[model samples]
Target: MSTSIKQTASSTTNPTTTPAAMPVKTVVITGASSGFGRLACKAFQKAGWNVAATMRSPERENELNTLRNVQLFPLDVCDRQSIESTITSVMETFGRIDCLINNAGYGAFGFLEEASEEEIMQQMNTNFLGVINTTQAVLPYMRKQKEGSIINVTSLAGLMGMPMLSLYSASKFAVEGLTESLSHELAEFGIRVHLIEPGAFKTGFSSAYSFNEGQATPELNRERGVYKKFLDNMLAEPPKPFGYGDPQDVASLMLKIAQTPKSPLRNVIGKDGKSLMLTQKLLGKKRLLKVIGNAAMPKLSA
Candidate 1:
């Protein structure tokens, strides 16, 4: 089933046979190999939208390829040429990309000291630069069409500073700022920019993430004693009482954003995501830092 995401355009021009006024809106999602991107591709495909699902390796995403409405494209957003080629290919086939979803980022959790500068750059490249590259490609199409949407997937960590996820947070924070500024610039073009802030979703994002290489070793106070135990507990196995959120939940919210006449520039989804945003937004940064510091404090006495 495909979701009909339509845009009302007045006329068609040139070699580009623009889609119907109530045209089958096309969606291009990066990182569709897994997680939210996969679910979203399926959701839109089922809803009848033309979905171009992209990943670094199309062969690896055979399952996603099985979906009827989606066309898999090879994309590595970090690569300038690959990003450009992808846009050309998609436009040649799909005519226009009504929505571009930037969902291709992974967590690299570690103390800033443990993570190398290269690692930090890699995180930012995939997480933040990826969006910039894709948006650059999609802009001209939307400019001509005079309507489009750019949906960015950011994390709660982006909004509030977290301990171990420093690099990840930095990357996402860049995305938050990038999306905010770009939104204002694109609005005049009749384009909408939205950021989806999700909590810990059960999309294997945690397991897929890499920790500081040697931090897990048995040496150098790796455990850090009781404090380490607490950190481990926080990152322990799932079956979380509330169950890590569903990717479908985020996908559903994406559809809501698409359908709504005017979507909030920033949408925080899931109870946990909303809760985090509330805490960070309501409690002054200093106060929030105090709470976090208190929570991560080691029991020096013990």
Candidate 2:
């Protein structure tokens, strides 16, 4: 990708000029090509905030390119240089960035044993370490401004364990911990760290979901056969407690997080996610595990 910044369409007034037309707060959203990232860009722009919609492929951008005061920047959270350059462009274009939404992670599915070493590393790098790097890159600017919000888009998997999503869960769990800790640390700098725990959303994320091909050896193939049956059985249940949701809801929640003063450190996006969390709290870990395990997975022989 080119290092040059892909800027947004001009609003009624020039976003460059200040304090004349409308006061515009700016937000930088990663993974802005599709799903929640795309929707949030539109939502924020609609709400009168200048949006820095950063994506890996700004060349392929469509709808956001038409919106006013919504600049497109090339950013790969895994690349420190890419991140730094994007922030610089954002600063140069928008004058200030009031929010950073770390939403550039893909789902890594299947058992831990099935995943390759590279897969595991990429999973953590994109989801956890990427968040760290992006946060670090943006902190100096936020500190200089004396106020900003850093929203980490996590999942229900971050809060609870699931059968096939071991590695995905682990990465999100790390993000949850990081966000919680940063909330306290950054509060002194007038910055807030928040996590948006969205449940399963029909965001085309599954298209990017990486499944470990565990068919390398005969033994592994057999293991995968059994795991497949378990996964099939689990998915057989239609209308899951946490059924798939519209990406727009998640986008709206993100806007709320960015705008709301004194928002909670962690915000679960859907009713199903909130319900699942409440169930865990009420049932306790042991009982909740047993209930979910029996309900979601096939029984394996001892």
Question: Judged by lDDT, which candidate is best?
Answer: 2
Model 1: per-residue Cα lDDT over 1-302, one tens digit each = 12332232223234245443577889999988888998899888888899999999998766877778689999998898999998999998888889999999898865566556678778889998988999998999999999999899998888877766788888899999999999889999999999999987888785677665443434535434554466567667653445577789999888778667599989888777766557778987789877766675555465
lDDT of candidate 2 vs native? 0.85
Each model's lDDT comes to 0.81, 0.85
Off by over 4 Å in 2: 1-23, 214-216, 229-238, 300-302
What would you estimate as the lDDT of candidate 1? 0.81
Which pairs of residues have clashing backbones in candidate 2? 8-71
TM-score of each: 0.84, 0.87
State the weakest 10-residue window (summed lDDT) of model 1.
1-10
- Cα displacement (Å) at residue 300, model 2: 4.7
